[model samples]
Target: MNQFIWSFLCGLGEAKYLNRTFVMDLNMCLSGAHTEDGKDVNGKDFRFYFDFEHLKESVPLVEEGDFLKDWHRWDKKKGPGRMTVRKVPTYKVTPMQLKRDKSNIIWRQFDGKEPENYWYRVCEGRAAKVIQRPWYAIWKSKRLMNIVTEIAGRMDWDYDGLHVIRGWKAQNKKMYPNLDADTSPDAIVSKVTKLIKEWRNLYIATNEPFYYYFDKLRSHYHVHLLDDYKELWSNTSEWYNETTAITGGKPVPFDAYMKVIVDTEVFYRSKAKVETFNNLTRDCKDGINTCNL
Candidate 1:
């Protein structure tokens, strides 16, 4: 079940033309980025939306033809008005959902009954490849995740200014639906503990430079897979800054994440990576305060 299931290309809209490559690996850092091809913004209506896959030709229009107009802007010939230029999301347009504007794209988002299982699919695969495992496979494992559930109740992280934790239902959707979190405490203690230990060993042997963690915009907790991006463009301090802003600079935000309620974590970078791990069951241990290595 730990195998690459599905993936999408990483490049789009950045170029005169988008260059995309499918994620063959499951363990790699990935984020869902939306394009303004024709998608609606909050309180703002739009003509349509299209997935970048459908983007081929560029259309023409007035001063602000598209939201890109602002970033790729031109001065209006004559107009006394301040307008908002939010790009439309044409990338997600379905054949049936085109032309007509959607009711809303921004909603109180959650993993719901299903966590798109896309959760970390791209990340794991990339990580597998990084470790020189050419035939790596990654998928939502209701089985292993069940292991997490029974033992910890949930695994959470701080993402894009949001506090995120997986509950039974949300984690279920993210896991293999047919399976359930290992309900028995003993099972979690035995099986789940073992896997983590083994994975840790394998990871240590690789001696990777840095492990990057990006909260999926939509799905998956991608561990940056490419050799080029072992660490994030920003450092641990930058991440702390972002988390602080998300929580309005609350003093105990990091503590909250590491404590029982929040359960947030980041992978270790080279020097930051350590063989020592503090068991949550333990009163305390070293490196618990460290962010992504």
Candidate 2:
């Protein structure tokens, strides 16, 4: 059964905000590489997330209606959006779980069992709006994109790239024991040697700050990191300073986020890719190496 599903908007949190890029990338891969869905997932998702149908005060981009305000005022905020007959009763699925999955039904059927045929009631309305549109799209910062593009283009898209995601996970030895052990600078350097030949261009994307960690790769391959383009992304850059001001000192680490986004995009467009383990598949992760594009 082919059921058309529409995703519901949940509040943006730390992990979800980052994870959505992967989802959008997956959708892009499903469609093809070097192409985008051309939709802004962040804007559309959050617009619904922040919709205040109950309040008299206007929320940006949401429709204004007297009845919506009156109904909510009388009912004392029964729900966030209009209710539909489609009540998919799920148990033990917390808001956090929903946030992680982004309302995709496929993630629930990972045990080799056939997934049930169900559709979101919301899809009926939104389906028309998204006609001829791709499944997912990402919202990327333009300034960051421009800078990263210029830097990535220097390699002429002819390089093998590595995505080394070592930061909190690597530091926390107890919680993610296997991940921590395998992602150490020593382990990464040892493993990546077999993946790349000497004299190849190697682009690395990592949260680790130790410039010396990549010395081995640098010796073998023409190494590139964010530090290579310090003039554009470094804290001293005027663009970075101005962005911080416009963000009003946002509590979140915006600069770190820019690196992650830029790195993900650049690596996605690379000639070949590699990443940390995918225990479930016993491989180097699906989206990283096998983009199927």
RMSD of model 1 against the true structure = 18.6
**Per-prediction TM-score, please?**
0.23, 0.48
- What is candidate 2's CA lDDT for residue 200? 80
Q: Write the per-residue lDDT of candidate 1 for residues 145-193, one digit (tens) a residue.
A: 2322322321132111112121332234333231123322242234334
Please report, in order, the local distance difference test score of every candidate based on alpha carbons: 0.24, 0.48
Candidate 2, position 241, lDDT:
68
Clashing pairs in 2: none
Candidate 1, after superposition: displacement of residue 26 in Å? 26
Largest lDDT belongs to which candidate?
A: 2
